[model samples]
Target chain A: MTGLADRRPEEDSVAMPRVSFTENLKRHVDCPPQDAAGGTVRAVLENVFADNPRLGTYVLDDQRRLRKHVTVFVNREMIADREGLSDAVGEGDEVFVFQALSGG
Target chain B: MTDAFHVATRKGLFRYERRNGGWQAGAPAFLGEPVSAVLTDPRDGAIYAALRLGHFGQKLHRSRDGGTSWEELEAPKFGAEPPPPSPANAENFEADMAARKAAQTVDTIWIMTAGGADQPGVLWAGTLPGALFKSKDHGESWSLVESLWNVPERAKWFGGGADLPGIHSVHVDPRDSAKLTVGVSCGGVWKSDDGGETWRQAGQGLRAAFLPPEMQYDPVSQDPHRLAHSGDTVWCQHHNGVFLSRDGGESFTEIEEAGPSVFGFAVATHPDDPESAWLVPGVKDETRVPVDGKFVVTRTRDGGKSFEALSNGLPDGPAWDLVYRHALDIDGTGERLVMGSTTGNCWLTEDGGDSWICVSTYLPPIAAVAWA
Candidate 1:
């Protein structure tokens, strides 16, 4: 099962993908990373939602653009632009995430 | 754990905790004259108290071993502090004085406690007339951010009567030290990306959906100035529901629409899950309560796309009342939920609003509840 046919990747992988990145979102009220699709920050996140429909609950609103508070990082670096997320991935890369939320 | 917290109320004092699913007051309550502020201090590692007297007259306190002991901090002797609300701003002085005497003040102090997460010993305060003040040296001294007071949105605040603002809740995200968001009651929400230097209303994706007449009711139309902004996306909780601001504060979209709990007071984003947050619905004007006559701590696990009432253990009696935004809070752990009510009691629900138990009482219908 090499994937692409399932809504959420459950039977696809023998090993979990690992990556590293830093979060630079404005508010720190958001955290916790979900699975990503590809190596690119956007692809990894899309893959995350693709594998876990529940992850879609946090990462996307009805409009499906990134929620205001949700940000994805690639290799410890934040991807400033949310619109273009079809980036490539590198093995052993670390992905960082952030939320754009605030409160007292 | 059960008897760890107590409160002093008018009808004596009461202490409570989660026994099973419902709440029950203690047979013998903690008796005192009642406290104005209930704050969890990060600096001293315990809860503290304070009493607000006009602008400069503040009586602060600390509980060394939690709420078990208390001591007052000497009020700073400001040699030339501006006179307390002078005759110039007091046409109805007597009435205003009376209101001040009856109304609770210091409890709106979460922002005033200072220092959390990355900020150590920073006292941030939001006040009526909607002003922002900061203290780098803890509560020993204070100085307004200075520029936030002069922001362009100031004029549009206060029914356009004055160019001042009411800084309701100053929340700094624990995850990101640079981000800060404060809400101004009728005006809207503002964000400080540069750590409170310059601020702009974050109104994108938010909707002031009070009908055209409501917008028309703005004593003054928001003068279309060149909104000095860098980004367009913003989120706001207006007199309306959760609003999303994809275009900063210029435009917005309403996210949650209860039948009539539109005028919500508290909106809390989830600590670990930004897509998930909690909001308490209140009456539009005290004439009625939220739907079902229950105080719901509704959660939207899917961001604002949907919301579900978490009132399984709340209430179904005459206990229903307005839950002010400042009155509600989630501890750093996000597992404990609390709110001080105008009904002279505060509540704690440990299991995500699955059930609620009064943690403290007789505290003159609490106006705010903050936990470190």
Candidate 2:
């Protein structure tokens, strides 16, 4: 019998990054987890936008830049590169996108 | 049913239909979200709802089948991040950056108005943080009207409800698409004669009692709580008093005798009768509730010279429900009027304010209402 952690090399190259949304964002649209195929954050978001195009508008500004209040995290690290969203993402990494609305 | 309408409340959006001399409430949409503004386009019969979610900031939804189903659309958002701190504020770049970031996020869409009948896909939205946005592809996409946003007078304006001032009313000329007027809370009314290419302060004669003696009559400092336009005249339920403009907002003169108290949030104008209007009077600004704890609606057929309190079927007991600016509306014929209060009650009159019927008793805090 083979365990999940035991299967490594062959599955590595094909592994996709998992993208999830906050509950707040989920109410606006049906955001189910998806395995995005991309090496960079921009590419991964583009893949997600491909499925729900309108979601991109809520997260991105007209100039195709991330809104000031919206934050994207890669494996619990807040994104530092906002202009291009070019932060690198590796296989099996979890990417989270959520709005940073503060106060009532 | 002769007419249909929708009411946007703190909890959701509800549609009301009049069938066989009775009114019915439809299933609520966006069931638990705070809907700030909602409008229906007369040209194509599309419904737009603006909601501010606790965690998601602000969002917009559109329904083509008259509120049966909804599709989320891109909300009106600032086009880009504020230009890097200007040379003047470069010394305090961090503070400047913080301020600019706050300006970009929309706290709410306070007002949504359909464009003229000719402009089928046109829609106008005034948002918190004091910006005006226009959509040309129906409600599909929006672009910020930077000309008005960049006006020099905007600096003097501050927030009335939220931390930043917001545009609460956008009135388009019934005759031309090129003419438009907007009422800003804390900021006075501004008008555009060239279809938003240029804007000018149009609040002359309106006084702000809270301002310094010398600045009391300064147009830009006057806070217009609610504004309505009918033909060539513009009417305002101001923070200080009721004001009327007879020359297309060129100037306003306070109508010193508008009953109960001049302070109110909701103002409605007859569709064809320029001199006819209605207002739900409240206590003064400090209290901002009903006067004497009684909910009364004042109507003026002679253009505010004198107002008659209309309370045929409304509560006369110790009730204190404040009507919001966008919560009062009149249908096209001006015979039917409806208003909702902050305490989750609505009243409707079908006989031009002669009598009123309680439409709903328990609803979410009403934010806005419009005839569909």
Query: Candidate 1 on B1-372: residue-level lDDT in tens?
Result: 232334433333333433575554545222323333445556556555554322112345555565556565532221222212333577885665454333322212323545556677676766555567676655555565657767775766663222333455566655555666666655666777778887766544444444385573342232111111113433344564556544435465566564346556666554555555666776653343566676677776664677777766566665666665556666555566776666765777776667777554455655455553
Q: Per-residue lDDT for B316 in model 1?
A: 62
Real interface contacts reproduced by model 1, as a fraction: 0.00
User: After best superposition, candidate 2 residue B150: deviation in angstroms?
Assistant: 1.9
Candidate 1 deviant stretches above 4 angstroms = A1-104, B1-37, B43-46, B53-58, B74-110, B159-165, B209-236, B245-252, B286-288, B358-363
Instruction: Please state every model's RMSD to the true fold in angstroms.
Output: 25.9, 4.2
| Per-residue accuracy of model 2 over B177-222 as CA lDDT, tens digit each | 8899999988899999988999999889999998889999998898
DockQ of 2: 0.24
Q: Would you give me the overall lDDT of model 1?
A: 0.50
For A25-104, candidate 1 gives per-residue lDDT tens digits of 21111334434436565566666556554444344432334444566666556665443344455644456654544310
In angstroms, give how far residue B68 of model 1 lies from its true place.
Answer: 3.9
- Residue B186's lDDT in candidate 2: 80
TM-score of each candidate structure, all chains considered together: 0.57, 0.87
